[model samples]
Target: MANAASGMAVHDDCKLKFLELKAKRNYRFILFKIEQQQIVIDKLGEPNESYDDFTSSFPADECRYAVFDFDFTTEENCQKSKIFFIAWSPDSSKVRMKMVYASSKDRFKRELDGISFELQATDPSEMSLDIVKGRVF
Candidate 1:
């Protein structure tokens, strides 16, 4: 199917793989660049709660996610940008969430942003977990 934003063709197989990884929470990060019509599932570094402290050692706008970047760039580029947010749940079983805005690199920069991060960070009592449990297309 053609992605509305970039008109880039995305195959069903690719979408399926993306969904599968998301549901399983198997990937450390997922980048859906509309211009490429490609969903890149990344297994980056380990999840660390001390991300904030780690990023603080670097210069401003550098290493927003401590060791990772909003654009999912290499360690070098991650030290050059700071346009992302990281949050942690207050419950006993704390959960960490990262939020960022993304779209076609050549098109607008903030398209397809916030929704997934909001949903992921939402209080379990506010929304039905079933939606996340099933196929989310």
Candidate 2:
């Protein structure tokens, strides 16, 4: 499906992996990158992975997209899980790459269908676990 605004198509496998993460709890996160004008899966993190593993997958000077399954305990001590859509455009990434990722993010995210939170980050601090927990609680 080519997005009219960005002219980028999201590969079918991306949605499949997202569904697996959302419904089956089969993955900790999914990393995506744009290649040949299409968004494709770059990696799939194991179900028991840590946040550090997810953060480490992103390149220092590139733009990417990801979905993370965040599990946390609420103030009442109730366990909850939320899926977050993250747009990763690091500060050192090329300006053109950043622009392209920004422009296509919405269209790409729309394809995933069940994200509970959306985060746009240019720096690691912006999308830290603390920030995610803050958003949840």
Candidate 3:
């Protein structure tokens, strides 16, 4: 019986099945942008050196806090825009993510548009932002 079971497991079809199962187990992080009544899903790339620089200034205990900046485009005028995401977790399990849209001319200043959301999954598949706050400055 042991020989028979091992033979079944060694089959090519069984190997393919295992590979498919492993692929399904993988998860990806998603970025969402909500403007007006429409919600857009944005794609995120790997973290850059700036992300490392930003986090290095914080203490080791504060590693749960992170900031991600990406390039995005506005819906109204389809103009290119830049966004900064600030995520923090007190326990390192549940994270609160905040979004800040920056002006093209003055990237340092935060715009009126922003969004906030929460994440509790060990590996989140998605994050969203609502652009209702308008301009703050």
**Please, what are the lDDT tens digits per residue for candidate 2 over residues 6-48?**
7899999999989999999999999999999999999999999
Model 3 misses residue 50 by how many Å?
A: 14
Relative to the unseen true structure, what is the Cα RMSD of model 1? Answer: 15.7
How well does model 2 score by local distance difference test?
A: 0.92
Residues 75-117 of candidate 1 have per-residue lDDT tens digits of: 4554222222222121333121111212222222223232233
| Residue 47 in model 2: lDDT | 100
**Would you list the rank order by lDDT, best first?**
2, 1, 3
Candidate 1: lDDT of 56?
Answer: 31
Q: Over the stretch 11-75, how does candidate 3's per-residue lDDT look in tens digits? A: 23322322332233121122323232222233322344333343333332221222233334566
Q: After superposition, how far is residue 9 of candidate 2 from its true place, in Å?
A: 0.4
Mark the regions of model 2 whose C-alpha exceeds 4 Å error after superposition: none
- TM-score against native, each model: 0.27, 0.97, 0.23
Alpha-carbon RMSD to native, per candidate: 15.7, 0.8, 20.0
Q: Which 10 consecutive positions of candidate 2 have the poorest summed lDDT? A: 1-10
Error of 2 at 22 (Å): 0.4
* Best-matching candidate per TM-score: 2
